[model samples]
Target: MSAPENREAFVRPPALELRGVTKRFGAGASAGRGARALDGVDLVLGEREFLVVLGPTGAGKTTLLRTIAGLETPDAGSVALHGRDARALAPADRDVALVFQNFSLYPSATVRENLAFPLAAPARRLSRAEIDERVAWAAKLLHVERLLDRPAKKLSGGEMQRVAIGRAIVRRPKLFLMDEPLTNLDAKLREELRVELRELARELETPVVWVTHDQAEALTMADRVALLVDGRIVQTGTPEDVYARPNSPLAARELGTPPMNLFDVERKDERWITADGVELARADAGAPERATIGVRPEHVLLDGGPSDAVVHVVEDWGPSRVLFAHVGAHALHVLAPRDCALRAGDRFRPTFDVRRVVVWPRA
Candidate 1:
């Protein structure tokens, strides 16, 4: 197929779509207190799109994933896969593959057996030769072919994860759902597998909805990320869009390494009059009258310009230095290159990167 036709052929509508999905737990007396796992959540995943869902524990990340995987039913909503109503189909019939956080492989099973299990489904009805072929293919794809004869119980966490991923891929499903598949691996292995997983997803040309609480994983792997909070999708966008232009304070807090420094400050005309009497020029003069002042640590400089402040603490974190300064009652952090010399108890004027400062309407 030509590039355009290949793209058209791959356009299989949305691999998954959720419309007004809501899930609530409990009853009247308990209902007033029950958790609302998902609230009117709506999302769409294009064919071959890799989307990650991020949220803290108890944020309903699992619930949302389960709903899509047919493990949990929403109280109110519709789930469609390839324009077909998904609620009508069972998990196996939906042509979806899910890899759980825990390597849920049978202890006695060898890697080959584990990879063959999904293909052995009655719906698949593949010949023994076909199953063996797919299992070998998947193991090769995940670089686990050498370990195909090893029992699941004897495999290392990373090796077992690869086997689990291999099993998922061997099914050749329309969509792949992963719930923190790399959470158990060591940092180095996790990083290695993350790259491999991305390549695998691309090579398979299947839509992937991966659930992860790790911001770095979500940012690095996803074509788009859906930030879930208390079961609601607070925001969804490309990593850069979500990080650079957070729609709310909650959304802003979810993305950054140290997170953006938010301070309740008074907005006077086109300037920010911090509680400590420091004045910050606003790049956007038409910002809300009373708003929160947000500036990332990297945007605050210790020297070479205007405002003055008393340093409270300086923390050395190898590659960079974080300076905690008191501007008044509010404490602000300034991230500086490690070579910059500044100490605690020192009073110095700091410069703000006006272009990077963000103003949000007071919450």
Candidate 2:
């Protein structure tokens, strides 16, 4: 085959695309004046891709999802699905499933009824047998079949969430928009559901846009992560790529656990030194004279060097210990093995993993 033929063969359109999408809310004193919830956001979702929209609270993650689901109108730009413009499409016509953070179900209704409600829509035109089959399939897939006969209000929080998810999956929509569906669950349950939902999406071969402020969910579940801040998409890349090479300091902060350690520094003697002449790390060959260097907690090592760090606190995180300490006048967080016996007030030396440092121009 020729190059052109190869290219044409794999040129299928993306599952979803947003071009300069912007949305605003709350008209102030002026009729058209309002706060920007989304500012010229652009993104693309490949067929069967799981893209996580990672951001902080009030960063417009929910607004983005709502706009995509047709529940909110964008003030500008276009939304497209599978190469077709969705401007004229209503919420139901879009054939997209949106699962919210709160478990949405009729408390008085049985789990089976809740799961079957979506199928009962007149537009679906699904036969009774087909509806039953779909509900059964979704319940089995989500492992909520045992609770099918119980009322939604009688189920545990985890169970109700499962049924709510079942309601969405029963439709088998072309796209899935999940808005932090597991945020309300307990930690262990959230972890369990995260893996389950990821596998389910893969098995169904569905494209999903999952929104979350939690970096753990984004890093563990996303095929790609879009870092949103201040109503704009700062960067988008695979989880590994974003974590390893964040385009900016904000992107670095969006995907880390305790977040990256960022501080302004000056370049001198081929190194980045802090304000007090404490060398932070080796300078990149093309690093600017003044820039910010970001070091991950794990990259800050307690090497017993001459850095003079006083431990402010030690947090045991099961697999590792996090040491919050002050090195000189700058406070830092360091990661150590769980077996380390460092206590508060203990003095130690901290070293930066120079090879892993990330630098950005000073802002």
Candidate 3:
């Protein structure tokens, strides 16, 4: 599809809304004292927008998704779809399709049968021919048409995942919710399917809310990302916004491959000393009065001559090398170009991209 046509096709109305949504488990008298899975979570998904929710484990990511799918009702707050109250709606009545992490397919059923199951719902009332057509279309979209006759139990993890996605797509629901749908597959297959799913979601022009802990997947597939922490969304923005300008230390740390290097900075008159003893310019430092500083590995540069310290370890990672150097009480990782002539115990000076450093208030 042409870029303009593709963008236009994906235009959609607000398909999902969560306002002051809070989900609590057990009574106030319980041992945990009413564990709140969600705490006043507020979110909105525009038509055809792909929103990926990311968080660490125990962050209530799953609970938030379950609530939206109508499998779990929020103890407080409301869910709306197309301006209608959705909290009172049943899972089927919500016209939402969920592709779960566990690949919740009937083990004994063939791929074709599993894909047809959603269409067979009494409320759908689809004709047999229509169901077949939908199943065929979804299978083609997911590139699983060849596995149609195989029983779900016999399919590989990747194939089963495709089947699960196909089943959800056959319903053509107003909203699509995926809970780490590619987590079960191998890394290579997961990467492959990530692109496929993005294309499929774009083609269908449906709003999607996907939950995943994989930062790379979030960066690659999501038009916008919601960073959830402790059952609350800490930040929400486009992948570029969140990655380049994270509002919190936690959000910045969560977006990188090796994660952002966090250090305590001590202000010494006009300059700041990172925990690793690298002197930082005051003009380039944010929160200069604070003690914490964060910089991504890629922003660090390795040079010879007058430097902070020497490289203690070098890990070659094909395109680049991660140089772990000792400056003081901490190790600062520097992402060096592959040809960088640095070895363990090599004397190296470190330079930082001043514009890329992030400073956080000391706690």
On TM-score, the leading prediction is 2
Q: Root-mean-square deviation of each candidate, in angstroms?
A: 2.8, 2.2, 4.2
- Superposed model 2: Cα runs more than 4 Å off: 1-9, 29-32, 304-306
Residue range 1-363, candidate 3, lDDT tens digits: 599888865663367889988887878823535888899999999889999999888889889989998999887889999778997788879988998887579999999999999899888789999999999998988888999998899998888888888888888898999999988789999999999899999999989999999999899999999999888898999999898888888887777876777777777665667655567544343345656767788987775323466788899899998888876556777888999998887876666676787776675
Q: Which stretches in model 3 have alpha-carbon errors above 4 Å?
A: 1-13, 26-32, 266-269, 274-278, 281-288, 304-307
**Which residue pairs show collisions in model 1?**
27-31
- Residue-level lDDT for 165 in candidate 3: 85
Whole-model Cα lDDT per candidate?
Answer: 0.84, 0.89, 0.84
Candidate 1, position 298, lDDT: 90
Task: Put down candidate 1 lDDT per residue, 289-361, tens digits, no spaces.
Answer: 6777677889887765445678888898899988888765667788889997788898877666788777788
List, residue by residue over 111-144, the lDDT tens digit for candidate 2. Answer: 9999999999999899999999999999999988
Clashing pairs in 3: 12-47
On lDDT, who's better, 2 or 3?
2
For model 3, the local distance difference test gives 0.84
RMSD of 1: 2.8
